[model samples]
Target: MKALLVIASLVASIMMTYAASPSLEKLQEGEKIKVRYTSQGCFHSSNYLMDFSPNKVSIYEFLDKKNKNPTKIGELTLSDGDTAGLDKLFAFYGNGKEKIGCTTVDNISITVIDKDGNTKATYHYNDGSGQAHRLEGVITLGEIVHRLRP
Candidate 1:
C-alpha cells in the first residue's frame, strides 16, 4: 500500500509538470521564440537572441550574407524598467522563394514604446526568400501574438 501511494504521488507530480505552461525557468538555450518590443520606431528580429535567460536576452541585428560576424546590437531584460509583462516578447523565422526575377529576403526586428518612451519588448523575424524584393515591418506585441495564436 505504501509503495502504491508513493508511485501515485510521483505520477501526479509528473502530470502536473507536463500540463503546466512553460515558465521563465523552463526556457532553454537554442529554443526559438517570438518576441515583441517597443522603442523609438518598433524593432523586430527573428534572429534575435544568440543567448537568453529569464533576466536578460542578447539582441542581434540581421546581417547581410557577405557580412561576417553579425553585429551585437543590444540587450533586453525582463526586469528592464520599461518592460511591463510577458506579452511583449515575440520571435519567428521563415524562408520561402518568390516568383519574381530574383529572390526576396526580409530580416526584421520589432519593438514597442510606451507614452514615456520606454521599451516594452523586442521581437525578431527573418523572412528569407529567393526573390529580390523584401517585405518587413515593426509591429506591436499584441499584433504578433494575435496573428500567431490559434
Candidate 2:
C-alpha cells in the first residue's frame, strides 16, 4: 500500500541527520522546539530519523544508505500529558560532554537544543565503537526511539 505523511516544520540552516534546527531564545512550556534522532533497533527493522516537537513528532525512513530524501512514515501528535515526560527527559540534560564506556547494544543518538541554538545535550547510543563523546543521560528514552519500529 502507498503511504504518505505531511509535517510542517522550519528546517534549520544546518543540515543534519538527527538534530533539531529551531531558534529557541525565550522558549516557554508548550512552545515550539524540537528534538530529532534516528533510531536503530536490535531486530534490524526499518529505521528512520524523527523530529520531535512539543505537540507532535514526524518520521522519515531512509530508502538506502546513499538516499538523501526519505519516505515519510507518519506523524504523531502528543497528548497534553506527554509534556510531563518530555520535561523530565530534558531535565536530565545539560551543556557538557562525558566519556562513557562502550556497550554492545542497540542505541540511537539524540540531540536537543535551547532557543538560542545552544545544544543542551547530545546523546550517542554507541555499540562499543571505541569512540568517546557524550552530552546527557536518559534511560527511558527507549520509548521515544521506539517510533522507528517498522
Candidate 3:
C-alpha cells in the first residue's frame, strides 16, 4: 500500500507540472524578472526583482532615492497559482501588437532573464501615460507579492 501511495503521489506531481502553461513553466525554471517604476515628479521610486525558484516570490525591492541600493523587503513565496495569475496579468501585452506603440510613462522598466542570467525580454517606458493599466497592475502585483512574504 505504501508503494502504491508513493506512485500515486508522483503521478499527481507530474500531472500538476504538465498542467502549467509554457510561460509559467519558464517562470518556475528560475527565470528572473524585474519591474521598476519611477515617479518623475518626485524622488520616490519602486523596484522589484522576482525569481520563481524555491521560496523566491516576495519580491526584492529598492525604494530609496539616495541609497541606490536594493534591500530585501518581502519574503513571500511564489506559488504556482500566483504565477498563473501573473501570467494572466501580463498575457494581454503579448498579443503580437506592441502595446506601447509610441506611448510612454513617467519611467518604467521591465526585464526578464533566463535561468542562466541571459536576457529574455525587456520593455522600457518614459514620459507618457499609455501603459497605465500595466503599470498599475504591476503595482498591484507588488502588493500581492508582498502579502505572501514571510
Candidate 4:
C-alpha cells in the first residue's frame, strides 16, 4: 500500500509540473517566427537565423558569433504545404518564457512575434546533457532550420 501511494503521489507531481510549464502559443495569421542558433568554440564561432513570416521564409548567416549584423543567405516563398508544416512544428513548442541554460558551446533560441511587433514568447536553450536535455525540442528546431539553409 505504501508503494502504491508513493507512485500515485509521484504521478500527481509530474502532472502538476507539466501543467505549470509554458506551452507554445498558437501562431496567428501573419505572425512571425524566428529561430536563432549560435555555436561558439575556442577558435571558431558562428550564428545562423531562420525567419518564418506569413508566406515567406528567410535564412541568414551572421558575420560574428555574437549574432550581430546578419547577411541574408537565402529566401524562399513558402508554399501552402510548407507554411502548414512550419505552423505544425512551431506549435509543438507551446508558448511561454522557457529559458534553460547550460555550460555548452551551442545555443538555440526561438521567438514569436505578433503582427503588431509585440513579442509573444521566447525560448532559449543550450545544448548539453543533464538538465539541458529538457530543452531537446529547441535543438530539434535548430536542426530543422539548418536543413532549410540554402
Candidate 5:
C-alpha cells in the first residue's frame, strides 16, 4: 500500500508541473518589450510595442516604419484563451547580422495550429541567448508601451 501511495504522489507531482503555465508579470501601459522561448531544444525571440485602452489591446511591430505589422504569434494574445493575460505579440526580428555562418534573428513567433489547419495559440518572441546567452526575466506589453509613450 505504501508503494502504491508513493507512485500516486509522484504522478500527481508530474501532472501539476505539466499543467502549470509560465508565470507572467502585469504590464503597466506603454513599453518596448521582448520575449524569449526556452523549451525543449528550440530557442527564439521577438520584439514589439504595446498599447492598451479601457477595453482593447493593441500590439505593433515596426518592420520599417512604413507600415505597422499586426499579428499574434503562438499564445501571446489575451483573446486566445490565455488566462495568463498577455496583451502584446512580438516576432523574431534579426539584428541584420550573421552568426557562425548561419542567419539568426532576435525575435520569434509561437503559433499553434490544429490538425485541420485551424489557428490556435500565438505567442510573441522577446530574446533568446541562443547557444550562448540565457534570458532571465518576464516582460509585459503594458510596460513596454508605457516607456515609449510621449
Candidate 6:
C-alpha cells in the first residue's frame, strides 16, 4: 500500500512540474510574436508595434490609435543568438502565466502565434515600470525590439 502511495505522489509531482513550464521547442518555423505598447493620457497618446518572426523582426511607429498605415522604423534578421535568448527567457518564464501588478501609464501586450495562426501565449502588463521588470529582469521583449530596430 505504501509503495503504491509513493508512486502516485511521484507521478503527481512530475505532472505539476510539466504544467508549470512552457516548452520553447514548441515554437516552430514561421512562429510570430507581436508586441504592442500604448501610452495613454488626457492630451495625447502614442502607439508602437513590434513583430518577431523566424527570419525577421520589425518595429513600426503608428500615427494613430488604430495602428493603421504605420512607418517601419526598424528591422533586423533574426540571429541564432536571438533565438537562444528567447529560449532561455521562455524557460525562465515557466508557465508564463502570471499577473504582473504594476501602476503606470504605459500599457504593453505580447502575443505569440504559430505558423497556423494558433495563439501560443500572451502577456499583458502596464505601469511605468521598465519592460523587463515584470519578467524579473530575465529579459524583455522591449530589449528584443531594440536589438531588431536600428
Best by lDDT: 6
What digit string (tens of lDDT, one per residue) describes model 6 on residues 4-111? Answer: 999999999877755543333345678887768776655646678877777567878797756799888888775666656655555544444452443436676668
Error of 6 at 46 (Å): 4.2
Return the TM-score for each candidate structure: 0.32, 0.44, 0.51, 0.51, 0.25, 0.53
lDDT at position 122, candidate 2: 62
Model 5, span 1-150: residue lDDT tens: 999999999999887644432222333233222332322223523345433322234555454534356444222234332213342122112232233422343444444334455533444443333322221232334333443442
| Each model's total of backbone clashes | 36, 3, 7, 5, 29, 2
- lDDT of each residue in 38-107, candidate 4, tens digit only: 7665665668887877766688988775658999877777556555554444434333435335344667
| Poorly placed runs, candidate 3 (over 4 Å) | 1-22, 37-47, 93-108, 125-139, 145-150
Q: What is the RMSD, in Å, between candidate 1 and the native fold over all Cα?
A: 13.5
Question: Best candidate, TM-score-wise?
Answer: 6
Predict model 5's lDDT versus the native: 0.37
**What 10-residue stretch in candidate 2 is worst by lDDT?**
1-10
Candidate 6's C-alpha lDDT? 0.63
Tens digits of per-residue lDDT for model 1, 1-150: 999999999999886644333223334443333332221212532332233444555654335654346566665454532122332222122222223232333444544333355553443454332222122332333332233332
Higher-TM-score candidate of 1 and 6: 6
Backbone clashes (count) for model 2: 3
Put the candidates in lDDT order, highest first: 6, 4, 3, 2, 1, 5
> What lDDT does each candidate get?
0.38, 0.47, 0.53, 0.60, 0.37, 0.63
Model 6 superposed RMSD (Cα): 6.1
| RMSD values, in order shown | 13.5, 14.3, 11.9, 8.9, 15.2, 6.1
Better-scoring candidate (TM-score), 2 or 4: 4
Query: If both were scored by lDDT, which would come out higher, candidate 4 or candidate 5?
Result: 4
lDDT of 2 at 85: 55
| Runs in model 1 lying further than 4 Å from the true structure | 25-45, 61-71, 80-84, 87-150
Report model 2's TM-score to 2 decimal places: 0.44
lDDT for residue 8 in candidate 2, whole number 0-100: 20
